[model samples]
Target: MISESTPLAAVEQAMQALLDDVVPLASESVALGEATGRVLAEAVEATMDVPPFDNSAMDGYALHHSDAGHTLPIIGRVAAGDSPLALERGTCARIFTGGALPEGADCVVMQEKACVTDGHATLPGDVPEGDNVRRRGRDVAQGSQLLGAGMRLDAAALGHLAAQGIDKVQVRCKPRVALLSTGDEIIEPGKPLASGQIYNSNRPMLVALLEGFGADVIHIQHVPDNAEDTRRCLREAALAADIVVSTGGVSVGEEDHVKAALEALGELNLWRLAIRPGKPLALGRLPGGDGQLTRFVGLPGNPVSGYVGAWLFLRPLLGAMQGCTAMAELPRLWATSTFGTSTGPRQHYMRVRLDFSREGIQAHAFTDQNSGVLSSCVGADALAVVPPHSQVAQGDLLECLWLKA
Candidate 1:
């Protein structure tokens, strides 16, 4: 079990051990139109070469290279999608862009460089063979791997698949997730707030974050600060989802029932991490149906902690389940700090806005570093990782995690 003083690197190592055995969700075949934002389960190979035939790249005269500087009769004309025409020796053909090259032609001179009159065209003397032509298989070759497994299909990837005449592809299924928000003091928005009641902010924020990470949230429930209720909700969520994520009720306070309930129904692997604003994070596994284990991650009740935890933990978990290699980790970059600060035992994940300029990348931290200040994350670009027991000065280099959705 990770203690409250365990460093972030040690916690990451522990989490990786849990994730090593995770099996990706099943794959399904979907049309190219529905494949956007899905991860490829298998490599896709090209069935036919792109631009299957040698064709003219411009509207010009197709002629033999030896006929350069000589006037030749224009025997025939060919437009795009037309069948290849045979060109006799010393004769030229009027060819448009994408038109198949004539059998006896070796080069094409653009119309700007060719003078045509009396059914004859004069070609430039310096024209070279294969000029103004698109060779077969120049863009893509037949029987070649077009896309690899675990690659996310974006617009360009989908278009590339379509270029190979592939209308359907196999992709990993979206990971199913269950979100639970705890605390009796938490009330839904639009409801009358009592003196001690605070509106529930973690549900909507986490739901959006989960969906953005490519998770399909199948279940969402608000569990009161009761131990029995927490246990019941977790059991049902474990049976239904690949992962069960809960916010609040994991601390050591009297109202904290999630930790106890998780222990009662499953195993708590790690309890805390050495990170500011999110130290009370929990990791565990519960038994699901079919003898499979459901991953559990409990985040703090504070809105900012939940937000930060979502990026740090939940995103990578979903990426692993969906077999998306690109989303396996957040992109890291080094930037010069524009603000000065100091830290103690816990590493601080300071929310900062990044500035790109000729000088260098600069990280500008928000003024308030408090965990409850959710506004600090509104326009934040990256998380500046400030090491424990260190002091940062202006212009000092720090590693930052880019916050990409």
Candidate 2:
């Protein structure tokens, strides 16, 4: 393929290659205690109705709607988890919150609204029909699926499941990922650095990024600029993980050994993207001597490039494995630019801070967006995607994606 194709073409190639190979991980049944942050491997349907029976919504007198605005004698008491009892005719029951209403009661008056004295409650105002009563199946009906097979389990989901007496769930096994960084100039943090050595921030950031995306970050390390060492590292990554993510040394620069190592181990395609911060991306399969294959992505070492590539690539990769349709999609919006801009042949994703101003959503660059600058990403709110060869005046429509908080 010619190197001068459009950016979308390159993105499509990389995305297609990844999509063709990302098989779903194994399935596991786990108690709800550990289901948080795990993807659902199967749908969860409510086997029993929520609330189980007609219950009071407030601590008050449970009475018939016909007794509204009438003073009825409280003859029985019902608290939460108690058996429902019959309420005598022209009588009411003093009920506590979440307590089942008496068999003849259909509504509840709030405690503050009804004056009670010695087993008698005077209900005065016109109470709406069935006021403050939660009927069976109000929260979730039996046989209705509340969560799907591929949904991400969140707090609300767990609460819903608990309401229906579900204490366990089946969830997808988290994908195992191995992270590596290539370059002789990179070193471990907290160690003495010689000249031209920088602390390895990419490993930490990438590991966090993978974990946040639902992948179990298994192994992480830095490989030197030697081809043999890089090859050995790739072998370990491919053997121990379903996907290998590495930064730096994919370009044509001397001492860049990652590309050669990948070629020696498997089939590789290097992409020249039209996006700023990250343009040189290597994507393909790692074929082992035993004929096993694993996916690999080689991203630029520049912090912004590495970060963006993860968003644009790693997100989709893991999202496909989980079967979430929306997770892989790029979020785009028309943001009002605070400054004029022009673009070269490459598409530019300018780090921006956004605010709601007089002209509505106003966006300005985070800093002088040199691809190598890392601090500008600290408070970035969005990315203004400037199209190739396009010019925009101040206050013009700029497409942007909101950064995850």
Which candidate number would show the highest lDDT if scored against the true structure? 1
Deviation from native of the Cα of residue 350 in model 1, angstroms: 1.6
Query: Per-residue alpha-carbon lDDT of model 1 for 198-246, expressed as tens digits?
Result: 9988999999999888888999999987888889999999999999999
Model 1 Cα shift for residue 49 (angstroms): 0.9
Which residue pairs in candidate 1 have backbone atoms (N, alpha carbon, C) closer than 3 angstroms, thus clashing?
Answer: none
Q: Each model's TM-score? A: 0.92, 0.93
Which run of 10 residues does model 1 get worst, by summed lDDT? 1-10
- Predicted candidate 2 versus true structure: per-residue lDDT over 267-323, tens digit per residue: 676555767878877887786335668788889988889988888889888878776
Model 2 bad stretches (over 4 Å): 1-9, 288-291, 356-359
